[model samples]
Target: MTRILAAALSSALLLASASAETLKDTLPHISVTGEASEEALPDRAILHLDIVADRLTATEAVTENERKTRSLSDGLVRQGVPIDDIRVVGVTLQSVATEEAAPRGAHGKHVSRGFRARSELSVTVNSLDEAASLLSRAIDAGSNDLRGVEFVVSDERTRLERLRIAAVKDAEQRARNYVEAVGAKLGRIIEIDHQEAVSATEANGRTEPLASASGVAFLRLRPGVRRLTARVSATWALSR
Candidate 1:
């Protein structure tokens, strides 16, 4: 019995050692990150415009805002903008004080009995050439609240797919370099993680109306190349 127990313990120890060696040989304890980027031009633009009306009564404010919003939508459609692209974001009614909450120097304070209402619209413009002009026309047609414009790529999936391939290659190259430096052969990849990033450049401040609203003016929509960056982390097995 004593001899059998000693043999069993020895066998267990040898098995554990072999397992550890196998794990050390196959598993990659080294992790490496690689990044790849591609430049692309944006094909779509999102225009956020708001039509606001402030009146003594909430009903009056809402009525006025609806009328103006309708006019703006019609004008945009007349200017060749697609009807389906227009979306109403929100409509709000809020009370305002006609009289100063605190008394000003001389004038007797008058209190407001009504509310103000505002309507917001978001339009997605597919054509870059028509974006600024359409916005200007919308402004002319009673769109007072021009929030801003955002440019984006319509076919982002294709770009990201290409970037993913490049990123994986880059990760593999980095892993190879690391293993070579450490004097080890790279084995199969054990794990991989991938992520994609999108970035854009835009003109923010208030823009003056172009001299020609209908004609194609030199709209310097210098959309900087949107960089689709992909980062991949790979764990490569190290072989002796």
Candidate 2:
């Protein structure tokens, strides 16, 4: 009986020591989240313009729409804009009922009067100086539907990489501060996770039609500052 009791007590002691070691291994790390933002003026401009035409038949409407789009494209090219930067993004053709077509019929049936055709174009201008002139020329070329305008940096990828580094540095600094406050020194990074970058524009709103007298003033419509933010969550090993 004494021998059996001694063996059981020894096994229990070894199990307790193993559990204590596992707890220590899991609790010796620190984690923190950090975020940072950078702002820069946009160097590129993207303009959205549309051409709409209505005619007695679908074929006539489509032909007119194509003619107007061609005119707009040629006008931009004449002003030294690159042909590769201009692209047709959307096209639509649908029959529209005019008042004349809605006249009461013997069988109370509605007739289709004409068809409307619309074409949307997306233009990317590298130089801010040419943004206003390009838009004005497109409007003069029969592009009456001005949809929207967006400003962006052509080299945003490089800027975002720099912000990522800054965010990691910011996290390290915070971890060090916390470790120091607890009377310990910072150690190697055990784990790291980078969050997606959030991008925002300072004045991202639809622009109104340019006044006939304010052609040059359109250049003053500057693409305000663009802000890019980065966040990171990092875990570092703790050291005494």
For every candidate, C-alpha RMSD to the true structure in Å: 11.5, 13.2
Candidate 2 weakest ten by summed lDDT: 98-107
Q: Put down candidate 2 lDDT per residue, 1-240, tens digits, no spaces.
A: 999999999998778667545544786877888877888788778889999999999999999999999988988888888999999999999998734334465344457889999999999988765777677677767888778777878888887788788889999999999999999987767667787564556567334445457543343346667788888888777889
Instruction: Give TM per candidate.
Output: 0.76, 0.75
Q: How well does candidate 2 match the true structure in TM-score terms?
A: 0.75
Error of 2 at 19 (Å): 22
List residue ranges in candidate 1 displaced over 4 A: 1-26, 98-110, 201-208, 213-220
lDDT value, candidate 1, whole model = 0.77
lDDT tens digits by residue: candidate 1, 1-240: 999999999999788667655765767666788888877787677888888888887788899888888888888888888899998989888888766555566776877767777887889988776787677667767888778777878888888988888888988888888888989988866667789998754434224445666574433343556778888887767788
Which parts of model 2 have CA positions greater than 4 angstroms off?
1-27, 98-111, 196-201, 205-219
